[model samples]
Target: MEVDGSKGNMAESPTNSQQTVSDDDEIDYSVKPEFYDPKLDDKDELWVQKRRKGYTSDAVLSCPACFTTLCLECQRHEKYVTQYRAIFVINCKIDSDQVLKQNGPKLIKGKSRREASSVGGETLKKVSCSACSTEVGVVDEDEVYHFFNALPSES
Candidate 1:
């Protein structure tokens, strides 16, 4: 019987180049570092409102009537007029299920855009607390509702 040494040896031995290629193909499924921002702690309502006059993106807002926590602090964003504009508007993205619809005339006549532009008409519908029927926020044309009558959950 002829001994088949070559086949067995090749299977057992991995060349340096092959080993490096295998190592390079390894994938890391770990979560991203930026997913959790350390700076969010400093952007809460207490800090932003005291200095800037309103909530920041890191403020936990809740329904004022029932005190139900509708949205977390991380869901908020500051709308500014310009890079150095004096006007600042803080808006929070609240879920639709958390609010009750109120009867009001349509605020905008056009579709909502993902990003605000000069062409798109800004629409806003009045919304209230689902649990207490208290006026809470306005549903924008983007379908993202804001907590206009919300207070800090911690307060």
Candidate 2:
């Protein structure tokens, strides 16, 4: 059998003359929202109060990089294992296939302190903006929930 060099075999390595481009050298491709739009109606008075107090619903966790609606904020709970640590659990209804199509190869695996140590020791998959490659949130192995770094539309 013949091996193709272009297929990136183990023996294939780019030389300095190949002109490799680092991620930093690439142009900024982060997606920015032209306008903020809350797709869902804010009818719940408790939600309004929470939003005013800086807690937002799932609609607010839109990605700043691609303006993708990442996850919906469900509720805030105290981390029982960690003192003074509060976690906002988020729910995502989008299909995993759709998420992969939008986020692309930016989804990576890493450890998060927010997740319970009992559940795989905080190791989870994180999704980033496909365009700008900015980390937006994390998804569990089941893709039921995501934890984001910023509020929706804040980016």
Candidate 3:
């Protein structure tokens, strides 16, 4: 019950000699825990990906006339869209069956003015709105797409 004033009123920390290290509890000094961004790493696979691959809200591309959902455009399909002549060519698998359904004489493919530029040398047809018979875009002979919907510029 006696209070000893021998030690000073200060906190004492253990010296290096007093510190302990174990083989199993090894510390990695080379690598540190950090927030990793794939775009910043040269060796990362995404590093080779588009530097200007713009981030856009997930969009549903539709027929400009009837507003029928033609395709779902996102960052994944954005990479496949390329420039062909004066129009942008969509060379990815979109929802073609529902968008380009045949009813009576209504086929998605109308005669296109675009040259014979296709994936397999097949003739490309202008994509028409199945509901409104409006020329929306173009498609290939394989029933796959090379869609040419020009997004209206915002003013």
Candidate 4:
């Protein structure tokens, strides 16, 4: 019931200030990656081609082939399309240091192992009208793409 102000008791150690020194030496407790593999702080740079203002529209029109108003243009509500041959530019930077540099086949890896037989080495194939089999165009690593516009040009 009485307060023990003695040296070894609660108020006992007059050298209590020295106890803090021992506590400072306690193991530095901190969370760290278990498998501390040091990684380069560099980040892969990426650039996105911005769509031109005039190229994109919110109008729709009927399709010439199907005469269906439900085509891609008509669905978008864009009636008067700015007909232009689109050169789809794809920049494939193939640095010698990069394992899959400018190599489309190497990058795609020919589909999953389960789909090995179903797919071939990734190659740029000419896109043609599935219905008409018309040669649309091809894509490659040079960042150059040429295709005919199904839509009309801006008059």
Candidate 5:
């Protein structure tokens, strides 16, 4: 509160009452504070003991284009390959995730691509993002979805 310049009356100033957020002031809402365990990074024997009790490792998979969480699973083998820009789950025997259910994989009728890097399948089904209909992954015969291609461009 401040005295009015002309009327001498107590009034609140705009600068004191309102706050403007700048472009630099961005907050990442993806990580939940409660679920964050700072001790996970500790490379000591105590950390191993703590994890042995009731520790669970979870990996959150999100769409590359829209950043919408596609899968939330504890499958320790699953990972997103940065070089290939794809997600690979060891063997997708588990049921589909909520995001994948909503935007299920659309099969490419009468077509399949020969994958050179996959250790499991010779050909995989190409899938698109529901939020984007853009090709983002390939699925194998075992129901494993390998997200994005890690193939480097020739040019």
Candidate 6:
């Protein structure tokens, strides 16, 4: 068996230089494109209306505990790494039944995006729970729509 000059048995071992070389060969995920355009624009009309009307939907849902109004908007994720969980559940309250009746609930549906600026065209309010800082709901011109109770808390 071969041994080092110090008489200790020496076995072939990976060096820091070899590890560095292997790491350099690894794929660079940061250079990959992350966003893809939505395949369909089925809600185009509703979306336009919501933006033009400033989310003036008349849909209303009240909190049984506080009687406070609520509404919702989808917020995109902050990082580009994982966009699947990008859409955030936002809340506020508004009052505009005429808009809701005219456009329908389908317009309220949100699509995830890669940009935070593009999230919530106009319907999404910036209201938060005055009590817990939790986003309670959002409102349009006529009423408020509360968030889904089953949704996990946004940390």
Query: Which one is best on TM-score?
Result: 1
In lDDT terms, how accurate is model 4?
Answer: 0.33
Clashing pairs in 2: 31-65, 58-72, 58-73, 60-152, 61-152
For all candidates in order, the CA lDDT equals: 0.49, 0.44, 0.43, 0.33, 0.44, 0.37
- Tell me how candidate 5 scores on lDDT: 0.44
Please provide, for model 5 over 1-155, each residue's C-alpha lDDT reduced to its tens digit, 9 standing for 90 to 100.
79988999999777933677765576666757777777766654455345334533234455565655443332333354342322333222222221221123343233212222232324445555565555555555466665552222211
Error of 4 at 129 (Å): 1.0
Measured with C-alpha atoms, the lDDT of residue 101 in candidate 4 is 18
Best by lDDT: 1
Worst 10 residues of 3 by lDDT: 83-92
Local distance difference test, candidate 3 = 0.43
Candidate 3 lDDT, tens digit per residue, 1-155?
23346864556667776787775579575785487565566553243234214433234355566566454432224454531222222322223333333334344432332422331244545565566666655455465554456343211
* Candidate 5 residue pairs in backbone clash: 84-150, 86-147
Clashing pairs in 3: 127-137
Give me the overall lDDT of model 6.
0.37
Give each model a TM-score.
0.34, 0.30, 0.30, 0.21, 0.33, 0.20
- Displacement of residue 48 (Cα, Å) in model 5 is 24
Q: Where does candidate 1 stray beyond 4 Å?
A: 1-57, 73-120
Instruction: Point out the higher-scoring one by lDDT: 3 or 6.
Output: 3
lDDT of 5 at 71: 39
lDDT for 11 (candidate 5): 90
- Model 5 residue 142 distance off true place after TM-score fit, in angstroms: 0.5
